[model samples]
Target chain A: MENPVQPLEGTTSKKVFWSALASGFLTLGLLLVSFGVSGVAYAVPIAGVGDFYVEFDKLVGKGYTFYPKMGKTSSSDSAPQGTNIIETLTIDNLQLYKDFQVGGEWIRVKITASKPVQISGLQHDAGLIEANAKFENLVLEENNSSDWQKQFQQTSSTIVLENAKLKTHYLFQKTINMNGMKLTVERIKK
Target chain B: MWWKRKFMLICCSLALLVSSAGLFSQGIKAEERDTEGFIIEADRVVGSGMTASLVTRETSKNDGKPMLRFQYNSATIYGMKLTKQVHSDKGPVSITLKAKGPVTVYGMTVDASAISFKGACVKATETVPALGMENVVMVAHYMKSDDSVIDQLTLNTVFGSVGPKKPGQLKVLQDLAGLPLEQLKKEIARISAGHLPLTCEDGTASEDLSGPIGLIPNPLDEVIGGVTNPLDPILQPLDPVVGGLDPVLDPLKPVLDPVLDPLKPVLDPIKPVLDPVVGLLEPVTKPLGPVLKPLEPVLKPLEPVLEQLEPVVSETTEAVEKTVQTVCQQVQASGGVITKELGLVLIDEALAKKVPLNQVCPTNSSVTSIVVKLQESLLNTLGLGNLLGKLIPSDPMEQLRKMREEIAKKPDGTVIYKP
Candidate 1:
């Protein structure tokens, strides 16, 4: 007799492993479907749902090339003084949504942007990431400025999603008052 | 012991899985649920056209004071409503943020025309853009309350580009132009009993006729009629001639000099003895040296007596004249003996004047007394008392006899009948 609980333990262990594997597969499946749908043209994600920002100086006519390194200050005089080193922001992923499913068949589209990017003026006091765009009607998730510079959020505003698909002239008029802020559209995954 | 440890491990793993699943579910649930902190409403655009109005019951905090601030009230673009707890410690504190309302925003971007904070406010910023639909004037009136006190300040805003676009503006101008004409007519009727014409920039009938509504007529016009004043040009007194001269004229000096010189011959060498015959009676004819003169002293006592006698004389004269007139009138009226008697009495009165009173008076009295007696005698001759006594003979027979005697001594010897 080789310990009576051996086979029983093995069977139970096998069941547990299989279940964990199944759960993992299900998560992967959901992610793959979302990725596939995101590949569709002119699609932007509804912003205010997550903590993310994107900034770009050049307007995207078609395709774009993104640099892995942080952007440099356009004006050398405005560069931070002393040992204050510029922090880098990591843009893990990028996607676009035109009419993505919110819940049921009711689909809502948003002009969105991915990749956490800081505004040019806000580079000195890092910790701010902005992305913005305009559409007919936009519903935001949250705008919390609790943690800002000196708790003094020197950052102008952090936009979650920016829709380049919107009318350029109209967007300025109806949406954002971009007095000194620079905006950029990120490249979608091919 | 190993088996027991494995069992514990499995139990912990199961628990962790269940908790993670629960957490995910809660997250999804939160997404679905509406937030109480979030507010939404409608705001009116105020203007001559469509106006956006906002009315709310919300509160906020300002400067450590519990201030009711505007968050996302009626159409957050126009005004703000307080939805969550806002805290401010120091410095000029204002937490004005925009929140979405019920209405769906359409087109490119929707910027507010203006943002105003009312009640207890530190500072309010306003940006009047096209927040609502076009042609709609947006008014964002914010009333914030600080420390339980609320003061309302309204921000009125209008939309539309610069310059006039509609026909209505032209109508306004036309109406303004017509105003003066109507005013002119009203002023004309109001001034001068509808007689004087209007005298504004738009002419008048004649400036001369126009007087203040109720004023004394111009002395110039009344004195020298017509508008072409005679005193205007010709015949006007010289300004230097009349200016500042004294108006008094002395009574001592003659206005003009006497015509003749004092040295001129004054004699008229008359026909000397041509009337020698007239010199004989010159003594008689010469004035008796005021024959009543020596009588003046004697008459001094009689002055009052004379004054007293005057009324008698006047009354007698009036009575005599009245009696004579009455007698004559009666006689003329009757054409009988009464006329003859009145005529004779009048003649006797006239004759008494030719003879001096001194010559006619009895010499027992003084000269003045004699004059008085003659005057009294003249009254008797006039038959005034006799006539009056006869008309009303209610007197005693002795009085009648005296009156008859008075009537009998007349120079004409006229007989008077006593009643």
Candidate 2:
């Protein structure tokens, strides 16, 4: 006759196999659920302090396109042959779209700066696009140059924006220095 | 062992499928939810020490207020709400936005509270053709902080075409931006008044008699008087000739009286026959008297001119007779033969002696020159000569040449003048 211990051992091995499979399925399910929830969430808060210099090959937005190039100079005498410098740059409602990879996970995120973004001494040769621009309190002086290329350059005392928003297709940044910086990344739904 | 392995594999596959489904379901749910396009909100935004080069197209319109349209090569905006919705025909389209804020473009600040914007995804229509390819169209109907309307402005990116990479065009629109509404309206009215037809304050079409009518009469009277006074010298010499003729005619009348004395009895018989004829013609001629009465005032001003011209006419006749006498005498002196050449020579000689050739042939004098001088004098007196000179160049030939040159410079097939 077969021993009772032998039958008990077989039953235990089967229970262990079934338990291992259930645990594996549960772990996978929880991971997938967490990823799904994160992807669908409207905002993921990120708090940090850093300064960034970003460049994009092409960024298409609602009413404009941007070709960002940092540290480029105008090929004109009036503008010296060096990087174009902006002393202080401030933007409000900045939005960005980009693809991110974290280890084995891939996420398409829309990052937004919900507060006034301040940057100091940003040097770039980016191209800006606009239509129908009007100026106020403008002062014009002769450049005393005969060449058409060295005609004139415009400088403003200040530029102010109210309730503005921006969206970009891709983003790359080199952080410099920042304080109390908050960014929210919302996963884009396909 | 084989069954357990297959069961584990099946369970892992099932878990993967369930997780993917949950992920997709959540994505779909998120997509279906309605949400605001803007992720940030702010009260104000200020940028310091900014410099940018842009390319753009510009257009303008006047509808109650001046409206400017700008089409840029590309533009990036801050502080805006951009909502995009997928459509069957046009894939994804951004909804129009009504945003409020203070924004600066170029150098001008638009302190508007509300601005309407139609994003670049809109399809091209007849009215707004520049609407696709990330072209942004912004229309700002601005009012001052005191609720007074300022201007209507339009800004957009050029559709499809990206212009030169450099800054092509720059414009300034700050002159009339912050002006008071009432003052601006008054200024517009003042400017428009010059272009529109003359009208009274009550909106009735004005007769506008004050322009030319008020200026005509005084100068016209002075011109007539001035013209008449110059004829006095021409008439003065004729007076002595007439006075001498009167004394000469007195001796002829006495000599003729004796011959006419016997004819009075012969005329008495004819006087009876002439009486009925005169009575019959009286009724027909009576109506003509009143017809001439209306011409009295018109001819009245010309009476002095005509009176001055009368003696000149007689003097001219006498001079012609003298010229004929002189020509005859010269012909007799030159072998008594009147040839065309000899007659011309004699006439030339007579004219050379100041025999008033202008009176004989009026064309010899510049009739237009005289008339123009008179008109110019009149206009000068009315303070209109200089103004008219500015409008119509003093030299007509020069003006015509300039006009021809301008017309020649026009492109071929251009309709410079339409009949």
Candidate 3:
């Protein structure tokens, strides 16, 4: 005998199938929009406490198109080969006009200061996307160079790096600075 | 089973449609407007407007404030900035957009004192033309909101448009020009007294001499301001020159006195011979003498009246000078921003004073306004003659009427015009 439960089971099955498909499609659509355009290139999505970044570069319509990144990275200056990359992140874009302030992409630094300083996003601030936009658990790459260690020991603030930009425009990027003790330079080691 | 599957499909479609509609209804309510974005420059066509893309989002915040972002090449407003939000007269974010080409926007409301669209043209629900993908037409939309009086629509352009598209613009102009000559004088006096009340030596307001209905004596001004006599041009400029030579001529008086003193005695003897000749010529001039003879008796009584009026004229002159100072302060306080409506009133007041107002009221319409000029030299003598050029439409009566409507004070003591 066909039981009444049979119709209920079939209806339940259909409901699960449709709902899953709808939510899956919605998530996929959002990912496609935020991450990259077209299937020509794959953009690596990076998330932070209060920021999100997409990094990729490829040929589009016979031209090289660059995707979003935390900021512009440049290799310049006299240090042990790639050591000058840290100093290049000295960003001073939206500060003031009187002091020859220059505009560029985002800057990063690694430090082991006297205090345990932690930079985080303000809870009340709007306009920021969730998850990857928040720069969470940020750390620098480690390097065991003896000379670099001595330099960090002598002066914790000096990181003399150069970059590939000379911009003097205004900026509006807001972020909290960090100063911490016994911190690891996890990303910068590379 | 097939029917149930089809039902799910219909349900999904309906759900999607409802969600889309809900999302579409809310415009950049919470988001900030960035005006610095979107610069329209000449496109690749060498003389095209610009290569720009506009992205708008109607935020759910504050019931919707549309956020507009623009990326462009070859435009004056560069980069990106958080623009001020704009509101519609009907309601907040009530603007609607219709496009013809690749021009796409996500939101409608703008927030700014002036939404400057250098190449873009904007009106209520205008169809944006597809002038190629790169060309952008930017127009700055500005509105000083007044929701209380929706019927009185006015047109304003930050750059190149008339006051408003509302009806009665011409009627208002006519109304301003229609102010009677005496009424215009009263307006000038009222405006001046309101700003700076002419005070007596005891610090009382000069109510009689320069008040709203100030018995402003014009006897001296009629003569001083008008070129009634033909010899004035030749003699007026020489007065200052002769006064400058007084000290030098004073020393020569002693030498010239002796030479002229001998002729006086000879001239005295000639007067006896001239008396009979003067009597003989009396008949020829007797008709004018009889006609004028009765005026002496009438004039004898008016001598005291005329003498009494001299002080009034002098007092009026002092009050007028003080009025000029007060009026100038008011102009400066308003940041020297002259409205075309106020300019018409100034023109009428200047013309009435016979204060050589052609420099300010240069338009022929001012002459065509009213035949009678004001008796007081309020505007022209006040050195406000240059301000008449700022009047709009050239019709004095219409501008005055417009001013009356625009410059009315709110019960809360705020201005209606620039509010």
Using all chains and alpha carbons, the TM-scores for the candidates as numbered come to 0.15, 0.19, 0.14
lDDT (CA) per prediction: 0.30, 0.36, 0.31
DockQ score for candidate 1 = 0.01
> Local error of candidate 1 at A122, Å?
25
lDDT tens digits by residue: candidate 2, A108-164: 554455554454444333222222222223222112233321222223333333332
User: Highest lDDT among the candidates is held by which one?
Assistant: 2
Q: What digit string (tens of lDDT, one per residue) describes model 2 on residues B10-63?
A: 999999999999999999876543211111122222322221111111111122
Measured against the native two-chain assembly using Cα atoms, what DockQ does each of the candidate structures obtain, in the order listed? 0.01, 0.01, 0.01
True contacts kept of each: 0.00, 0.00, 0.00
Which candidate comes out best when scored by TM-score? 2
Candidates 1 and 2 compared: the better one by lDDT is 2
Instruction: In model 2, state the lDDT of residue A151.
Output: 24
Q: With candidate 1 superimposed using the best TM-score fit, by how many Å does residue A95's alpha carbon deviate from the native?
A: 7.7
The digit string of per-residue lDDT tens for model 1 on B1-419 reads 99999999999999999999999999987543321122212243211111121112121211111111222222313332222111222111111122232222222121121222111111112122222221222121122211111012111111111211111111212322344545634532343233221111122322232433112344676766864676577545666565534342433234333323332332222334445556756765556647867877888898889789979988987886676445334433432332234534433433443433233223334433433443355445554355444422333333334444555565563423221
